[model samples]
Target chain A: MSAITFIDYAGVAVFAATGALAASRKQLDIVGFIFLAAVTGIGGGTFRDLILGVPVFWVANRDYVLICTVVALVVFFGAHRVESRYKLLLWLDAIGLAVFAVIGAAKGMAITGSPAVSIIMGMLTACFGGILRDLLAGEPSVLLRPEIYVTAAIIGAGIYTGCELLHLPGPVSYLSGVFAAFAVRGGA
Target chain B: MSAITFIDYAGVAVFAATGALAASRKQLDIVGFIFLAAVTGIGGGTFRDLILGVPVFWVANRDYVLICTVVALVVFFGAHRVESRYKLLLWLDAIGLAVFAVIGAAKGMAITGSPAVSIIMGMLTACFGGILRDLLAGEPSVLLRPEIYVTAAIIGAGIYTGCELLHLPGPVSYLSGVFAAFAVRGGA
Candidate 1:
């Protein structure tokens, strides 16, 4: 439980940094950076919770919003020192994507117990945040790219669901999902 | 009560048609059309509900989904007969914007009882769906356009919130909002 919680916060921070990086590219101010970061960090989870008819995580626990804001603040001040913001954004996105895919799938499985819906939820969780960030920042959406992004999320989520079906231990299943997603995304 | 409900459904239908028109411009198949239509029709309300911590409108009542699907099907077969799908889309979007702005504000007022938040909610409900449509269809977002689009929503939502503060009758407040929004957008 502690491990999952740590990874979840870490994923949000990573995603939030990507959003702040996007804002810096757009030459937006501090408020814009924070707004983009918050949306990019939690947009996918918000959508998933809405569809699942559950309380939104950020609204229920303001800590998520705080994390995003803190990350945005850090990135806003420190971004000038980072070389190749785009490359950093991609690597951070890959890490966040792997974590979020597994987390989202686990949440969906716990709620709905439907493997198909859980997989879709996992994909949405991993992908929608970046999609929202790009839309708001007016960047070309990653979805429009021919890269193997969404496929990595699917592989991660699929492996997790497969492990659950095979009655694997929790940590083993979770690690398998994360590594699968990271391998595919990082390889690409 | 019935009037608002009727207008709500009509707004959804109009927004769905605009999404279908976007799909036609992209030369997408029926599935794509339906997907875009459903998202555009319900996207704003979904965001509003999620933020307000309420059950999503379409998820609670399947009629909204049905309306979008039906509108998509109609546009799929009948689009070629229209002289200017783009013009029609603009007009329909304008109407939907008007209706949704007022309706969204009303819902927000009912839920939160805060005029400022209600006005913001109104703007979100009016504008977010089209933003989602444009984003998904890869159209330059209406938000990026230097038109009076978002301003119209603000005007409508603000007026509605002001009317509530003044303790005006429901119909008067509602019509004032809708007409103000339409006048701005249509004139633009």
Candidate 2:
């Protein structure tokens, strides 16, 4: 698999786990856990694909669905043993956000050839999953907060788009974007 | 415009009005009203189109967006003068749901030719706008309630799909579906 594919899978898994964690906190049933996981894992990408007029990635490849389900099940069964669930959730979310932002920006650039659009796509892809998760859980969405989440996504996407415009090496640009997003989120 | 297009526009306008009403309850700004209205009007169709691998209807045609925006603005400015907002909201929502279900079922049948899939698409198109609006406004989704909302959507969609499979005339199937949904909702 390509680097982007690998990161995408990782992002989906982490997001799915976070969704399961949220479901567990809500004391939802197994089906609810699965639904939340799937939506959180794929919602952002699905929204981006729809806006870009492309086939939804998870729909085209059932493997992504399988991965999300498996991750959700694992998290549902195992998360109780982990201490500091909130900390773990935050870190996993930060990692997922960074990876998804990079992947989304790259995809947007490939499809639209517009740096501004790519950056916006990146931000949307990184943030929308958590937004959906929060919405479904009936919690205040992070978007309503004065937090640094969206700003971090914007920074990462902007960096990636700028590097691509400068013709930077692919891996270099991607790693830089991820690092920037992570740092911003971690610092916040 | 075709019959479907006419109903689609009407569905969008009614949905937008509901969304604007929702925003009014939240005491949100005008921008929030517009955002909620647009999402409520288009969210379901967008989700259906993405799953079906088709171009999003609103994105493909800017007129839908314009209609949603105009309706939102009108509702935002006029809704306060209206007494019995709850009754009006319910009736408008019922109309939007029926029209959206028929349009969604038709589109799904035209694309997939699967009765079950068409029925599901119809229900999703009918119900998800309200779901999104509730989520955005931090209200408990109607899905979590024991209300007859989703049941009404399912009845309508199933009727539409069944009629199509029996080779019923276009308008007959459409009106029957709408009437069935409306009766179920209104009765509840």
Candidate 3:
């Protein structure tokens, strides 16, 4: 698999785990856990694809759904043994957000050839999973928070899209975007 | 415009009004009203289109967005003047739900040629907007309620899809579906 694909899978796994954790907190059944996990893993990409008039990525690739289900199952059975579950969820989600933001921007740029739309796509990709999870779990959405989550996504997406528009090398642009997002979110 | 298109516009207007009313209840700004209105008006169709690998409907027709905005603006400015706002909201939403359900089922059948999937599409189209509105407003979703909302949608969608599959006349199928949905929701 390509490095980008690997990163995307890792990001999806972490997001799915977070969804499963939320299900546990809600005392939902196993079906609920799987449902939440799949939605959280795929929601952002689905929204982006719909807006860009592209076939949804997860629907086209069954492995992504399988990965999310496996990750959720693992978390469901083992999350109680972990210390600082909330902290772990936050940190892992942040990492996933940063990675997904870069990937979303790249995909948006390729599809629409518009830097403005590409940045918005990046932000949507990075944060929409958490938004869906919170909405489904009846938690306060991070979008309504005063935190730096969406801001971090915007920064990452903007940097990547801008770099691409400037004709920067792919690796350099990717690294710059990911590092910027990680720093902003971690620092916040 | 076709009769179906006219019904769609009316449904969208009603949905937008409900969303704007929700924003008013939350005492959100005009921007929040617009956002909620747009989401409520188009969320279901967007999900349906995404699943069917079709272009999002509202994006292709800017008039839908304009209608939503106008309806939201009216609601934002005039909701407090109306007596029994909650009752109005419920009735309007029920009508929108029934209309959208039939439309969604028709669209799904056209795209996938499966009555089962078409019924699911109808349910999603009828109920997803309220699901999204409640989620964003931090209110309990209608799905978690004991009401007959989704049940009514299923009946309507099922009747419509079944009639089409059985080669019934178009007008008969349409009226049967709408009348069934209206009776179920209104009776409950």
Candidate 4:
């Protein structure tokens, strides 16, 4: 798989973990965990694809759905053993945010070739999944918590778009974007 | 204009009005009202189109966006005068539910030509917008209530699909679907 596609899978895995964690806290059954994980893992990308009028990524390839389901199953049993699921969730979310930001920007750049649109798409892709997770789980949104989450995604996407505009190497740009987003999210 | 297209517009307007009313209850500013209205008005069709791998209806034609915005503007200015916003909201919601159920099923039949898929599409289209509105507004979802909201949509969609299976005339099938939905909803 290409680097972007790999990162997209990683992002889906992490986001699915977060969603399953949320489901655990809600005391939902196994089916609920899977449902929540699937939505959280694919929700942002689905929205991005729809807006860009592309085939929804998971629908195009059912492997993503399988990945989410497996992650949900793992988290369902393993989550209780984690001492601080909230902290783990936050860290995993930061990683997912960074990953999705770069992947979304890369896809947007390829399709739209407009930096502004790409940046917006990146932010949407990174944040919307978490928003859906929070809303579905009835947890207070991280966005409502006065955090730097959305800003971190935007800055990461902006930096990636900037690097592309400056003719940076592909790997260099992607690494830079992910690190920047992780730093912002972690530091906050 | 086709009956389905006209009802689609009407559905958007009524759903937008309900969203604006929800915002009013939350004491949101005009911008929030508009945001909520647009989401509530277009969320379901967007989901359906996305899943069907079709161009998002509102994105393909900006007129739906305009209709949502205008309805939001009117509601922002005029909502305070209504004696029972909640009651009016319920009635309007019922109308929107029926209209969208028929429109969505019709669209599904036209595209997929499968009764089961069309009925599922109808239910999703009718129920999802309201679900989004409730989630965004932090209101308890209608689905969570004992009231017969989702069931009404399913029954409505099912009836429409049944009519089509019987090879009913176009207008007859559509009208029967809408009226059956409205009766189920209103009777509840």
**Candidate 1, B1-188: lDDT as tens digits:** 49889999999999999999999999999999999999899999998997889889999899999999999999999999999999999999999999999999999899878776687678889989999999899887786563377778988999988988999998899999999999998998
Higher-DockQ candidate among 1 and 3?
A: 3
**Deviation in Å, model 1, residue A126 alpha carbon:** 0.8
Q: Write the per-residue lDDT of candidate 3 for residues A1-188, one digit (tens) a residue.
A: 98778888988888888888888788888889998998888888887887888888998999899998998888888888988777787888888788889988999899878676687679879888989999889888765553478778878999999899899998888889988998998887
Look at candidate 4 and give me any clashing residue pairs: none
Q: Pull out the clashing pairs in model 3.
A: none
In the order shown, what is each candidate's alpha-carbon RMSD?
6.5, 6.2, 6.0, 6.1
CAPRI rating of model 1: incorrect
On the 0 to 100 scale, the lDDT of residue A40 in model 2 is 89
Q: Which 10 consecutive residues of model 2 chain B have the lowest summed lDDT?
A: B142-151
Model 1, total clashes: 0
**In candidate 2, residue A48 scores what lDDT?**
93
lDDT ranking from best to worst? 1, 4, 2, 3
- Badly placed stretches (over 4 Å) of model 4 are A1-43, A50-126, A136-138, A142-188
lDDT of 4 by residue, B29-123 (tens): 67567767888899999888877778778755667878888998999999999999999999999999999998889889889999999998999
Model 1, range A1-188, lDDT digits (tens) per residue? 49889988998999999998988887776756776787799999988888887877875566787898899999999999999999999999999999899989999999999999889989999999999998888987889883688999999999998998788998898999999999999998
Which should have the higher DockQ, number 1 or number 4?
Answer: 4
The better candidate by DockQ, 2 or 4, is 2
Interface RMSD in Å per candidate, to 1 decimal? 4.7, 4.2, 4.0, 4.6
Report the C-alpha lDDT of model 2 over B1-188, residue by residue, as the tens digit: 99867877999999888888889888898898899999999999988987898878888799989998898889888989989776788789999998888888888899878776676678779888999998889778765442477667878888988898999999999999988988887887
Error of 4 at A31 (Å): 17
